[model samples]
Target: MPAVDWRVTRLSRRRSTVTRAQVETVTGRALGLFGLVFGAQTVPIALVQADALLPGAGAALMAVLYGAIVGLAVATVTKVAVRTACLAFALLYALALVAWPFLVDDPAALHGAAPWLYYLCTVATTAAVVAVLPVWAAAYTIVVPAVYGVIRLLPSGGDAGPLLAVLDALYAVVLGVVVLVIVTMLRQTAGAVDAAQEAALERYDVAARLHANEIERVKVDALVHDSVLTTLLSAAAASTPEQQQLAARMARDAVQRLDEAGATGPRALDRVGLPVLVRRLRAALTTFTTPFTVRVVNAGGVELPVEAVEALYAAAVQAMVNSLQHADEPGLSTRRELRIRGVRAGGCVIEIADNGRGFAMDRVPAERLGLRVSIEERMANAGGMAHIESRIGHGTTVTVAWPQGAGGAA
Candidate 1:
């Protein structure tokens, strides 16, 4: 490829990549906001209950410490830094709960016989952290929760104390399992949301590009019609033979320019399904032209590239629009026939053929510019071909062969 072409392709690819990345970044930010909401609720509850959970410290002090840690962990979610911070805090929590019972001579009475709640709390806290933590934090969460629950069940007081502790420890283990299940469900939901958002953004980008392309083509069409065609017409009216010949040449160039304009835009391609799109076009065609029969032979489940689909739809719509606009009769308008089919031999191929009031393909007059932009140019760029079989008074057969996998999905 030439340097200019290569450069253009590279730039286009880079822009697409950047757009997808922006979508992902937006999703990440939304997830972060959600985490903050959860943290705001959970942290306060943990702090208020800390005095009961950790008897040695003042409730305010414990709450503040735990709140600070939770806040720090939330902040680090933008990076993976929060995982280590959370794990370290969990370890500290384990040490404090373990040492609490041994701090006083009458530790059993101070802890109210059963300290199983402390172990369970630790396990739940660790499980919550694991949801937001890095992938590697799994080991610490699984092991620590299991170990603490088991250790907390050991004999401490008489039969009553021991039995209560064992039940509490069992409850904590169950709590940890519940947290793990919730976390997994939330992760799957988040992933599905991300995928849907990505797909939506991709569709939007394709639509914007197609619109911009159409505007550019229209501008080119207007320029040729307003300035160049007018000049050519004026020149052709001059008496001089040389002026007439030159004017004729200029007129031909203008016709070519008009045709070139259509080459700018891609075909219309609807990604969800082609039949759904075709049905819409058929309905729109009904509004303008009657006695127009649309025969869709086959449109199997064939996925096409975005660009190819866009091209196919554009060509088909243009053909139908032309039939509605130009092919009317004085009293009895001609009957138009449209045939659309899809094939997936190598890749998808959508062929749309319309038989309506046709024009003479051989003698395209100096004024006829619609075919230039709508038929010939657009199909060429889409890596497709357009064939028009038309005769005056009879109908025109416009066949558009769309090559799939060339254009991006529209």
Candidate 2:
């Protein structure tokens, strides 16, 4: 599988988060609608009162001035459209309703402004503020209409005045209930949406982790199968002459021993000594190649952890392959050599060196997948280090080192 670039992955996740936020912002439809309704209602009141309502200015001057204010309010707060005559007419209608009662100065002119209709409209306006506006805005809207209605109805007090007050209270209660229901439902829906989004993100994270884990397991299995199994199979099928041959016979026996150990090799890390494991590695290397010396200089007197053992083994195998592949053999190239050294200070170090021509470190890119997966990553996971040193004519050395555990006292 191809590796994912972390920077690109992070950027994609960030873009998705931003898109979700924009969707949430647009969900406030009620607020935008209320702004349009209130702003449109301001227009016609300014229009008809333009002529007779000027205090000092002449009718023409007053008309133009009021028209400007209405136009400004409509343009800013409502959706403007040059083609929609119906919307313009609706604005004109609202203006006439608001201005007619004041301009005619007659109780009869208030007939179109039915008390029940006025109650519903004012309550709706108040509820709109409660639903979509800020606390102070809702208060201002409710207070203004309430005060005007009370002053108009109470001063003309009669037996019916109390009935009107009762009706107003009933309307207030109904509006309160409606607003409560609407707000509650909207809040619940918003909460559910947020929860669903959070769940999706969590699932994505889990899926990504699972896929990464499976890929790593596949890689480890492949490495062991290809290197360890191939060598052993050759040894098992060797002929009588090849059996006596050091290189051919050693290759065959290394595989057999490794297979036998494979049954208990893992347990060796937990219970066996580092000295035995290093000796086995040396024997395996000797089995496969002649004129290549395999020696353990120091074992550190410690048994490494399972992770560290696996890392050391893998690094040694890789080093043997490199020696076989690139050793400088002008004629027979029989002078090729390999060594394994173990040390104990704060930690155990497993070093593999070969007599082979090496390339410059910079010749290998950081993204070289084989080296990263095989050597670097394995040691790192075990809290260890894999260090490589080499020059053009000189051989290469690969060292895998990790701190000793409490039980493994080298």
Candidate 3:
């Protein structure tokens, strides 16, 4: 097994998190379907008023405008062309609104009814907001409705009085603003969530490194006392040639041990590869008194801090020891599992589960330090967390993860 490096580095990877882009994709799909359905509803209304439009080219123009909107909606939902489709829909709708007067066969054809284009102002605005920047979406939301309001007052338009046109414009603007605000809020919230998740992982990484330093200090101290001091005493007392030769060999071994623990190790922020951690863990598992069914799924290329690795390994061993001491039944055969798997951001999850007589977590006494202090507290100090799940006669599972919150890797 490769030696455990005492030096730990700052975490640079993130656990699985809810990102802004993920929320935006969902928002786009939803708005795309919204545009598609509402845009298609206006089609029957357009067909009914088709005669009022210019002959021959009127229906073709209607199809072109509606086709683009609906097709873009489909593309948006499929995620093949979201922003591009929304941009096309917004631009096409605005141009269509400008050409509405010319498309009419007669200026007075629709004596009182509002034009079909008036109903689609919000849909176009929705597309703009979903695809473009806030400034441009706001511009479209204001300009498109204002243009529609103008068309509503023209002879070629319904020629409705100013009151109704203003009311219609205000309603569209309000609706567009509401949609834009919702999209913006969702995006901001998702971004904050992503940030929080990253910050938490970083904190865990730092804590784990500190704990690793402490553990290493104690081990190095023990090595110096047991090996180096013993060798020095033997050298001082040696008189015979054979005894001196043994003392020289002992001193050499002590030097080699000190070298391994000295300042020549990895830097404080260097990554310990997952493969090395896995190798160490497997070696530790083989030392256990009780055999466990083990499964390993390596997360390729993940490198975590030395402290995180040490913390996870220590927690797993504690959990196994806990199971050996407690999980048992007189007449029942017990089975246990040890699963170590790679998680997001190069961290790992270690699960120790047993199908034996189990005890409730809440009932585990505060005085018992096996689960509370040695296992759970140790992991917490090391920037990881230990989770205990159990019920009487069902089983117990102690799940621990580095970078925090990566319990789902199992």
Candidate 4:
């Protein structure tokens, strides 16, 4: 035999709960119908049997009123409301059933000589009790019939022996026990089904999150291979003195990349002022071969988390490096600009623009990770975003922004 799939079992249990609830609702309505039919039959019988209609008339009216209320509540109310109404009705009906014999003008009328209508009322009320409160209904079922047996044994009972009374009581008790067991089992089954559904939903959520993290890790690995490793290989193959100097700068860039990777731990990236970060980037740019200008506006006091700062810094540096390597003119002067500004709505914006030859963004090679990984993905991982605009003729512009109150990715 195949091993049981717990997930499938849990899903099946969940579905079964709805079916059980529907069945219980139908059963409650059926009991209501029984009450309505019993009341309709007994009311006229009660009126005809009693000669005077004052206290006796009140009992007949009460039977109709109780039955109507129970029927209406069960038919129209929600599941919870139906249960509440049934419980209330069961308690009141039990009390009335126990007192019914004593309320009559003739105590002998309740003995073996009692009308069929009287016995019918007892059976209907007992059934309603059994339908709603299973445990309490069992006690009521036993108590009600035992009370009738004792009443029949009295001197006023007339012609009723102990054997006949015992038989009548036993019938009611047996029927009640059967109804009680069924209702109890249904309730327990519904509860177990509900619990299984909740467990299944929790497991599904955990699985979905694990799948997403795996996809993200794959993307990060591809990014590292394309950018850092490619730069190291190119730097090792340089021939000219100027090429060697450029390769030394690339080696320093590679070391910075390694430092950023090692600083991925939360403790290493402490919150720092935006102005301090801008000043540091300005100092780093002085070593570059290309002429560059750094500009800061209204960004002196803005604070960002360490991880966000590292991500923004790395993305800005990559954009500058790309401009130096790719954007060049034979005779015309070319310069790159780095602009940092604090947004009034919160967070900060960093823009890197070049007045040099720009390439088509869509035509960039898939293996090239300068814009994809080092700039865009890095910013996204920091809970920020990078936007790049470029045309073959017009210069390239890269804008990186971190939104207000963003916590960098873990």
> TM-score winner among the candidates?
3
lDDT of 3 by residue, 1-410 (tens): 32333322223332344456567678778777777777678888787667788786568867877788777768766666677788898898898889888888765557678888877777888889888998899999999999999988887788889999999989999999998898888888886875565455446556655656777788888998999999999999999999999999999999999987774432244455565555556667778777887666665566777667777777788888889888988887889998877876577888899999999788878899888888788777766788889999899999988877774633
Model 4 compared with the native: what TM-score?
A: 0.45
What overall lDDT goes with each candidate model?
A: 0.53, 0.47, 0.78, 0.62
TM-score of each: 0.39, 0.32, 0.55, 0.45
- Full-model lDDT, candidate 3: 0.78
**For each predicted model, how many residue pairs clash, with residues at least 3 apart or on different chains?**
15, 6, 3, 0
Which sections of candidate 1 miss by over 4 Å? 1-88, 98-105, 116-142, 153-163, 233-410
- Ten contiguous residues minimizing lDDT sum, candidate 3: 1-10
Residue 128, candidate 3: alpha-carbon lDDT = 92
Best by lDDT: 3
- What is the alpha-carbon RMSD of candidate 3 to the true structure? 17.7
**Model 4 pairs whose backbones collide:** none
Off by over 4 Å in 3: 1-19, 59-63, 78-81, 107-111, 228-410
Q: Quote model 1's TM-score.
A: 0.39
Give the lDDT of residue 332 in candidate 3. 79
Q: Between candidates 1 and 4, which one is better according to lDDT?
A: 4
Question: Which pairs, if any, clash in model 3?
Answer: 8-268, 9-269, 208-382
| Model 2 regions more than 4 Å off | 1-27, 34-145, 154-173, 227-410
Q: Arrange candidates, best lDDT first.
A: 3, 4, 1, 2
